[model samples]
Target: MTRARTLPAASHLEARLGLEMGQYSCAGRKAINEDAIGIRAPDGPLLTTKGVAAVIADGVSSAEAGREASQSCVTGFLSDYFSTPETWTVRHSVQQILTALNRWLYRSGQGLPDARRGFITTMSALVLKSQQAHLFHIGDSRIYLLRDGRLEQLTRDHTVPVGDGHRYLARALGLDIHLEADYRNLALERGDLFLLTTDGVHDVLGAAQLAELLVNAGDDLAATCRTLCDTALRAGSDDNLSCQLLRVSSLPTPEIDDVVGRLTQLRFPPPLAAGNVLDGFRIERELHASPRSQVYLVRDVQSGERFCMKTPSDNFSDDPAYIERFVLESWIGSRINSPYVARVVDPGRPRTCLYYLSEYVDGMTLAQWMREHPRPAVEEALYLVCQIARGLRALHRRETLHQDLKPDNILIDASGQVKIIDFGSCSVASIAEIATPLVRDSALGTASYAAPEYTVGRKPDPRADLFSLAVITYELLTGTAPFEGKLERCRSQRDFLATRYTPSYRINPRVPHWMDGALRKALRFHPERRHGDVSEFAHELQHPNPAYLEYHQRPLMDRKPLLAWQLIAAALAVAELVTLALLVG
Candidate 1:
């Protein structure tokens, strides 16, 4: 028979916070307090003056490592990442911290005994920033936002099924023998009661029990939390119990401002002709077309320098949001300096129709080049991914994410060099809110190359861009993507791969082993297992093993069109000879 561990005093937890922030955790009849709760106040300046906070972890006793791992997760994040000094956008900061926690717990659990091996816990953390509730969770820990005497469960649980293994979560942290997490965010309202609890509460008590306590708890949140623990104990919960009661003491209410006006009926006539001087440059001719922007080839009259001018699409001339985004991109784009990035020489004035110029790249986009040359040599493909990675590293260093990284967004110069373009989806590190919503309902990017996370509703990050680049690189190397081809249409992202796998040697018997391995890792469904940054990907590409070149360079079969035609002719001649002999007989 197993002797149970002793539970800690409820007072240790109860005494930490009084009325200002009420919280409680109980080990029940268990010997250890595997279940944990974390409650914190905004320690520094608020982006919207609304406090940022969270409650986390309901340790699964069956998973013995749950208690410490979960506790470490909450405390670890609070100590290392909270109140970031740099002006990082809320979304970026949240995801980055969660990612760190995931890796730490995952690495810790590796190689332990089966009883303690990969010990895991459910997590539900809420950050009340900018009057909005940013929620991050995994496994079964619960988050409830209560208002008007009602409670709302704000998180989805990851578990395995009981009867048919159906209730089982398809995804969870530290469960599938791998470490990763998923999160959701929402807007918050004052007078909201946020509940974070263990499965003991959610599993044993019905909605009526939860509703009754919350409604009666009233303003005495600490008393309400205690009652919840008592109710779970009375219900004879077989597992540990814990609950955190949070009231949105204050919800940020932003002051109203002027809305951007509609576009005017007047269309922007064609820009000045070539040699027509304006500002410090002379206009030449239009370089390309875009839905909301136009580019022109121009030369600096003073320095005789040539550059490409970017102006907003004639349709959005009046949309201030569009104008603002355009101008913001110009400022961000000018600082990019990598061989793979289209050079942005200057961020010109935004007053007259919102325009900026970049160095005129004399090369075709990767998209156009791909159309002309369906398959690229192995070396060329490797070189391209390296360059793209280098460019991405520059952007990452600047604390920016490309948000959109695809073949069409990359240009190939006269020299087999690659250049990344299109900063319209670029975002600064300080802004937590993502502005793009078009892709949520419909497809957001070029379907063939969009990352699975991007295809779904997840916010774009550097890893997302890496996924796209990996797909594009795969397509370039094998003359096809790992999924969604004309011959076999991949129905979903999961279809292309189940577990991580290197591209099959069968595709191009010539593909280098190391190159294939790198691509496969980049395309891993979980972000935590993949390379941390673009710089890592670049380093691997540059140092590809010699075996990779040797395998790919060997002649598998004569692919030359002339050889195919010769083979065809030889077959026809043999057929004629056989037919002639039959006639004579």
Candidate 2:
């Protein structure tokens, strides 16, 4: 593979962060150079998503296909690692690609007449994502870190001493069917330097000498790599020589003020009106508007297709926290693909304003629908709730959480299809790992529909969303909230514990006893007491579970002794009044 001499300069906010890299390889007293190196510094979204990757491989001198093995390992890893799903974490993406590459190399080496002639190589890779350096290693290649003028080895040699000043590789890419690569993460700072070398370079130069040479090299990294290779060859090394140097020039500031300043720099377009055109899209009418954002019904002037364009409100233009959340909402919409979720559209032309587009749906919000229906049947409520659960499952699978789940966030189309919308409050697992100065709290979701744990500052889980779903279901059947406004009044754990759930059957006698039991279990005070998963909750709603039925069958006295005693006293007072009236007659 050909190496790129110059990478594109970082733009906008990313301009504050970049990397410098240098590499060199040569045949040192060997017939052929079997060592290979590769580096990739991507631009745009890839710079933040995949980051930069550098790899070095050393082929076994005794193998006939050693050169091919080393080249393939370096090129394949760099190419495939960038093509992985952006939603995946850095550790997951690299490990999966390495496993597949190892299997292919192992199969190609099988059935060889001599084991020494098989394809084999050692590999070490470094990936810089956000503010962390991820390292993957195998075999005898070495990786080192030079920080604060101190050099330290970060990888262990995968070799075993045999006899008489000779050591054979105990683990390599093609040596066995099962491959175990060492993986670790290190915190990166602005001036940190990383060095990657084959056995040839490290075997010759001691730690103190290598550090002194790197320090003296100053600003010229390419010359430093060339010097390291030449010094190793002159020291009587008999293997292929290779070395790579990478230095962090800067790191992106993740402070809330910085992020907000970058995002809010784009001026919001002047108040749009019908018949106005902007960025190839013609405005038809206004769909919705609020203090946070405005949604407009627009048509692509070229194709005449309708779409919904959403833009941030100027009222919050100076609020950094709100601006950051607005930008993340669009990113989340693009990554998730599901029928039950609204699709985010990419404009064929460059956007002139700070707005995003989505496929327009002629539908009403779930809140509006509930107001019209007032009392939906059990079967109808189950069907709608089940569709919402499916949408939640898609987010959970991608390690995302819809922290703001409520009737207002769901839409029902004319054809009766359900789609979840409004991701401004969602929390993404992979994005959370990135170093940022924003302090995340549990105040994102609405108070009435939000789970009790969130109000008390507990970490949210899938069960929290389930609690919101159960609240919606109960309201759909009985037109009343289960907590009777207690969730909105709660300010602490004590308030949540003091709240009690009113049976759904009491509000609407049409609700079956078993179904009420299912709702009660899903609305438990503690997350652990709720259903294990959304699917489990959906199943219980359709098929009556004996356990839920048994719990519901318990007498009113067992359920609430105080309420039962109050009712008993009222009954006795009425009976005494009747006996006195009979005596007076």
Overall lDDT per candidate, in order of appearance: 0.66, 0.84
Ten contiguous residues with the weakest lDDT in model 2 = 1-10
Clashes of each: 11, 0
Candidate 1 local distance difference test against the native: 0.66
Candidate 1: tens digits of C-alpha lDDT, residues 1-585: 011112111110011111135677778888888877776664323422223466578655666587887788778666554554333555567667767676666666776777344656778877665445678778888887778887777777777677953365554456654545666777656567778888878888877779888877656666777788888889888778888776655433322122222122223435556666656677888777778777788888778878888777768665655655665567678666677788777534433444677778889888788888777677777788888888888887657777777787888889887788888877666533422221122233565666666544556668877877788788878777664442133345565454334464558776767777677777776677677877776666657856555655655444345766888899999999999999999
lDDT of 2 by residue, 271-316 (tens): 8999999898999999899888999999999999999999889897
Q: Which stretches of candidate 2 lie over 4 Å from their true place?
A: 1-13, 27-34, 59-70, 99-122, 157-181, 254-261, 273-282, 372-382, 396-399, 429-442, 459-485, 493-585
Winning candidate number (TM-score): 2
Q: How far is candidate 2 from the true structure (C-alpha RMSD, Å)?
A: 6.0
For model 2 the TM-score comes to 0.77
Provide the global lDDT of candidate 2 against the true structure.
0.84
